[model samples]
Target: MKIGVALPQMAPGYGPGTTVDWARRIDAGPFSSVSVGERVTFSNPEMVATLGACAAVTERVQVLANLFVLPQHPVAMVAQQIGTLDQLSNGRLEVAVGVGGREHDYRSLGAEFKGRHQQLDDKVAELKALLAGEPPFEGADPVGPACVQPGGPIILAGALGPKAMRRAARWADGISGFSVRGDAEEIVKVGELADQCWAEAGRTTTPRKVNGCFTALGVPDASEALHSFVARYLGFLGPKLAEMIAASARASTPEVLAEILDGAEQAGCDEFILVPAVTDLKFVDVAAEVVAARS
Candidate 1:
């Protein structure tokens, strides 16, 4: 399976130079892709800027936005930005789009939180049009360069539910999912659901499958480290907290991580993105070890 690393966008004490350095390090490693997350709040770096930096410095590694909030931004602008980035990167851009869930983020962005699913569907349709080199709107000329690749960058829909899965199969080139607590079963379930949705859509071509797992590496004890990590990261999701906490308690070792990766690969995941739970940059070294051992 291909390996990817989450850009150190949220790493503690991170700055532009440190972020660039980490990108370079990961690019020099065995990773096939480097990804960044979108969060207007918290300490996370801006997704596009971080990705632009990585693209500028790396030659071979694919640059991805693990997910961008589609409903909060104008579809035309997003398409243009992604097209430009894809051109700049020589066609190595992959995007995962989603209807963001955080109410506070929507409020902050002056976006209506209601009917987000419908908005996402519309935005994706428009984006596809723009990426296809269609005019931005009636009576308006196409705004930017056609995407670098034919039919534009690989579009991966970030999905969780049955409805989202169906939409992904219909509109996206692939599906991207986060494995809560690094659970192999959850990863497999996501792949199965996506595959089922694709089959239901009567799609003959197999869509790409990407799975991400967040884990704290280099801690003194894996279980304690994962417990603390989940309490902070997963607990913030409220209702999902108990389930994530339970999963963490059940599996929290390098051996478990290996098993998760193996199972994810067996379950038809095309790519795996790993996020180091700690903010320390040293966690990258630990991540490197895990990637090497698994490889």
Candidate 2:
């Protein structure tokens, strides 16, 4: 299985230069992809713009929007932005869409929170239609410049349940999943269910299985830092749950992370994206050293 690194965009006080530097470092490192996640009501760097900068600086690694809350934005506009991002990355962009669980984020953006799943299903279709160069409306001109990829970039869904799995089977090229502690069994179960959904839908091909986990590395008191960051990032989920998530983050030391990597590979993860709990770029170097030794 290939290994990827999530940019430190979500780290507190992280900025544009740091985002670009992280991308550059990932390009120079042994990672296969550089990814960023979305959150409108947070202090983190904006996902789309930061990804654009990453695309501008890196030539080889894949640029993934880990989870774009599709229900929070206009469909055609997002299609245009994603198409432009794919063009900027020379067809290296991979998108993952979902209806995020945060009602606060939707409220902050003035987007409706209810019926988001249905809205996401509609928006996904609309995004594909727009990317395909179909007119945005009955009598409107098509959006441009067309994607560098013939059919646009591959689309993945952050789907974890049966209903979401069924929807993904219909349109998504894959599913991007997560386990806070790098639990191989949990990830494998999710992958099997996604495959089952595809088979039930009569699809001959199986969905790509991508997994993610949180960690803290190369910093003093790494575990503490990891827990603190997780607590803050998921504070909206309530203190008890946030603390629980913080407590469950995988250890980022080489020995522990190597075990996690082996477990993910054995569990059928085609790509494993490691999300750092701390903002420091040293985490990348530490992760690289571990991954290189394993490779």
Candidate 3:
């Protein structure tokens, strides 16, 4: 299994300095990818800018927009930005598109929250066609600065449920799944569901299976740190729900993280990315240690 780390763009206290430094560290480590997730309504830096920073500095790892909220942005704009990032990464870009669960984010972006599922289903098709060099309309030129990857970056569905997986099989090369509790059984179940959904979609290729876990390591009171991070991140859901979700976070210490990695690989993850609660550079080194031991 390949290992990846997320730039702490969304964590509290994150800044451009941490973003650049973390990107360099991840690039220099035994890591396969550097990921940044999206959320426009929050304090996090914009996904494209953060990912652009990673791409500009990194040479060895794939740069991922791990969960680009598709419905919140114009499709044509997304195609252009992704195409540029794909080139910027020298063909080492992967995109995971999803209709994120946050309604407030969509509202704040001036994007309609309703019918987002349908919007996403339609936009994915449009994005693919645009990336494939199809003109937006007759007599109109195709978007320029074409992708470095011949067919464009590998598209992943940032999906978790049966309905989303079914929609994904038609367009996505894989699912960028996340386990809220770092559950191996959950990841295994997701792989099974992906297979079932793909076959039902009449797809010939097996979907690439990958999973991610939010972790809190290399910190004193790691468990509390993880809980605090999750609570803050998921605070939009209400204090009750946020606390419930935060308390359930599974991986906090190095030992717990090691087990989660083992379980994900055994659960058939082709790649596993870390979402860290803290931006301390020690997190990267410790993760490298754990991954190296497993490897």
Q: Top lDDT: which candidate number?
A: 3
**TM-score for each of the candidates:** 0.91, 0.98, 0.98
**Where does model 1 exceed 4 Å of error?**
219-226, 234-236, 239-253
Task: Give a tens-digit lDDT track for model 2, residues 142-179.
Answer: 88879999867888999999998998899899999998
- Per-residue CA lDDT of model 1 for 138-158, tens digit only, reads 899986877778878888999
Of 1 and 2, the candidate ahead on lDDT is 2
Itemize residue pairs with steric clashes in candidate 3: none
Give a tens-digit lDDT track for model 3, residues 1-295: 9989998776778865898899999999999999999997788998998899899999999999988899999888899999999988999999999999999899889999999888999999999999999988899898867999986899999888998888888889999999979899999999999999999999999999879988987878888888999999999999999999999897888899999988999999999999999888888988889988887
